[model samples]
Target: MTQNPPIRRALLPATALLAALALAGCSGGGSVRVAAPVTTGSTAEQCAALKAALPATLQGRKLRDTTPESANTAAWGNPAITLRCGVGTAAVLDPHSPAYDLNADIEESGGVCWVSEQTAGGGFRFTTVRQQATVELTLPAAYAGGQSPVGLLAGAVLKADPVVRDRPFACV
Candidate 1:
């Protein structure tokens, strides 16, 4: 065995530290920054549960830790698909508003209900209309094909939060 010189040993530690710091950051997909979501205590608590339930990877992409990270939000992939919780639910599922997404498009699977739609720019926007807290998901246009993150998140929400289904007369 050969012993390294004194200078070489000191340089090795510095090199290792830099490598470790680099790995702690968001992957090459890039770190997506957004304002920290605002929520009431009850909603924050629900979001906390959802945050804990989020997987390290979704749609086969590594999770990206957002700037000003919070329990109310989550992200995955290079372009970064983000999920925001504690949103307000609709009073009624509308059919005419530009932001309106039909309940008819909602799909329930793995104990979670999802309403997903493609935007004009070709990206996808999805939201949970029937869960305890409204969780909104956004996927960039670059990632047009992949397994949906809906089921994975649904499982997590089911475990951490309450199941909520739309009612005929209740708020959407």
Candidate 2:
């Protein structure tokens, strides 16, 4: 009987990962399905629009199917880049007393503005500043790179709802 070469077997995992990534671009295949962020009424409507505009793939990860199938929340990749729309005001948003100093923690990237805070587990929390129903995103430390989630989320949402950036606040 003939058998595959050792080198072929060694390449299996890498081959599988590439296949999965290609599938992700088609649908949110490789993404982790998370519980939808809770919302009601018009808030839900707004989030739905944001959801509709979210990319099929994010940061080389697919946008996974979320639990409860809600437009309020989304996740991508294994480490799980989670994004929640229609979020309540974050304590750091208080311009009078920001959770962190200006431009230090809260900075703009890819045209999206956010206030960042490190999670206890060493992950990061990035929340939108100018939008009405705040959008919060969480990413693991290893995912840190030039490709910012802020830019992606903001582009998707703003394109869907041009006026979503209501109630702008200054972190001065």
Candidate 3:
């Protein structure tokens, strides 16, 4: 029976480890997983416009593809900052809800009103308030400490689905 020399055996394990790491890196760069929002009629049209208006890069992160692609979804970066248009208004926005706190929770950026919520994973989710159709943006925990990127999305939201004058909420 033939046996590998000590040096050859050592190199074999090192080579295997390098190959595994390379594969992992490649997988990480693949498409981001995002649940596309469902839109209909006018809302669908609005989302399409918003998708087109979304910046090619967000917070210095270049845009990346999303799985099961749809016109209402977009993503960027390895940790993935994701956006979904034409979503239903967040339940927390309701005045009657116990979690509602207009003064404390609402934030205004680029003339748009937003409400932010911390996710279980320590990330943050910001959603537009009082717009024709809600748009949600999520930032991974890696972004928890930096300046908010909600402002970066304001232009596209305003251009595609400006706030509805009749809606109850407004950025003050």
Q: What is the C-alpha lDDT of each candidate?
A: 0.73, 0.72, 0.86
* Number of the top lDDT candidate: 3
lDDT of 1 by residue, 70-130 (tens): 8888788777788888876542355555566344467775777666788687998776766
Model 3 segments beyond 4 Å from truth? 1-27, 95-104
Worst 10 residues of 1 by lDDT: 163-172
TM-score for all models, in order of appearance: 0.72, 0.68, 0.81
Candidate 1 Cα outliers beyond 4 Å, as residue runs: 1-30, 90-98, 101-104, 165-172
For candidate 2, the lDDT comes to 0.72
For model 3 the TM-score comes to 0.81
Worst 10 residues of 3 by lDDT: 95-104
lDDT of 1: 0.73
Q: What are the RMSD figures for all models against the true structure?
A: 5.4, 7.4, 4.7
Count: clashes, candidate 1: 1
